[model samples]
Target chain A: AQSVTQPDIHITVSEGASLELRCNYSYGATPYLFWYVQSPGQGLQLLLKYFSGDTLVQGIKGFEAEFKRSQSSFNLRKPSVHWSDAAEYFCALGYQKVTFGIGTKLQVIP
Target chain B: DTAVSQTPKYLVTQMGNDKSIKCEQNLGHDTMYWYKQDSKKFLKIMFSYNNKELIINETVPNRFSPKSPDKAHLNLHINSLELGDSAVYFCASSPPGAGGTEAFFGQGTRLTVV
Candidate 1:
């Protein structure tokens, strides 16, 4: 089935450390990819998206994602992590109806 | 001003009761959707309305129905709600397309069935 997969269910990083969240898609062709973040008691906020363009896409909150066609992956990354970055992250894709992954919970430590 | 908004930020009701959650998007987008976020924080697409037309309906139960009076408003009504239905329901809107574009989301409505 065509879907998005986030390998890591939970990740913990120290403040000021780098962060990477892995995402892979199993689609017949490259569909639009997106990364969204949800803070506690909040709605899902779009961090970044990938369409038909350059592989690397920059998003809000000092985040970026690289879409690798060969690997079918669009992993989100940040140069340095912050405590406020601790939240639930979701990777999604679709052409008409968007689908989301289970989500990855990030815990940032000071 | 909020781009997307859902009413009744918190709802607590008994099982077997019926309820409705209203959603509106002032962004003037043509596509609106209803998504259910389970206790585990897993998001699932329930329904999609484009220009007030039902475009996508997942394998959701008949008890859950979505109504779109126009392109700007989409409401979800649940009949005989069950305890298992307790979760955070979100309403989102996007530009005329699919998941390819970023969606504007409203603060979810947390529903509790006791």
Candidate 2:
């Protein structure tokens, strides 16, 4: 069965600091990977996705993710974190049926 | 306009009652889905429809049923709702094809069983 794992349950970073959220997947083949962000009382918004192109993919809100086939990882990163960046981040894997990670709550501190 | 929307942003009902949640998407996508977010904040896929046809149905209980009148609308009807059924339900949509496309999500409906 395909599964997504987000090792970090929660992460806190000061404003303007760099950020990285780890994600690993278990699948037989290179599956479609995605990073989504969910704000409090709001629905999820796609940050980035890796299908079959370059390893590094850019997304909205200055978010970027790198897909590492060797490690079965698709990690999200941002150079500078902002107060508005505080939210729940989820890593998902799928093409027909998707599986979401437990999610990581990001807290941006000033 | 909202790309994806679910009616009854919040719902409170007693156990054994039957309720339905309506969802609609104006993005003209060919695929729609229902996802449940439990109290633990774990989001899981319940069902997916493509072009109004059932495509993916997870291990959800038979009490829960999804209806898609068209490609733009998908509704969930729960019968004999139980306390364990209380959770936030999200409606989402995507373009045709495999999961290569990013899905647009609704604000979600918070269901409470009392």
Candidate 3:
């Protein structure tokens, strides 16, 4: 049984401000982690994924995440958020189970 | 070409009617999946087919039947649709081998039951 937890339901940040979204997971086997972004009425787009190797991974739209094995955390970060960056973000864990977090709704203020 | 596509981008029908949503992947992938996104925007996997073999099937009602004519197409048929069934359904495709392989998603079909 695999599960993902995203503590924040909604997060608001100003344009050009840094942002970090927290995600935690519970999985027995080696976890396959992913971060996805969903815009209004659009399909989810992959931001980044962590399979193995370097814990720090970079993704599209200036997003990055670090996989912490001890803490079971894979947090997504962006140095500076753009207005268009506001959307729903989901964190997923495992390959077989593939449980997704409740999702964090990001709001970027101009 | 679209990697994954679903027909009837919008479906509106009355309760108790039967409707079907078709999905196809031109990506030549070996795996296809059906997911539902409810009004709360929570995405849940309903079924997964790998190479036309049913690999995963959630606790969906028998009214929801999925048929994979081949590896490239997986269609979902629903019977006795109810208002609670209104949601956006997405179809995704991916190749077999590893799990982390990115699953390409279709534009999604929004089903509304009146």
**CAPRI accuracy category, model 2:** medium
Which candidate should be chosen as best, given lDDT against the real structure? 2
CAPRI grade, predicted model 3: medium
From the highest DockQ down, the ranking of the candidates is: 2, 1, 3
lDDT over C-alpha atoms for residue B47 of model 3:
92
Once fitted onto the true fold, the runs of candidate 3 whose alpha carbons sit more than 4 angstroms away are none
lDDT, ranked from best to worst: 2, 1, 3
DockQ of 3: 0.56
TM-score of chain B of each: 0.97, 0.97, 0.97
TM score of chain A per candidate: 0.97, 0.98, 0.97
- Model 1: how far residue B7 lies from native, Å: 0.7
Tens-digit lDDT track of model 1 for B3-39: 9999999999999999999999999898999999999
Give the Cα-based TM-score of candidate 1 against the true structure. Answer: 0.97
Better of 2 and 3 by lDDT: 2
TM-scores for candidates 1 onward, in order: 0.97, 0.98, 0.97
Output the number of the DockQ-best candidate: 2
Q: Tell me the lDDT of model 1 at B48.
A: 92
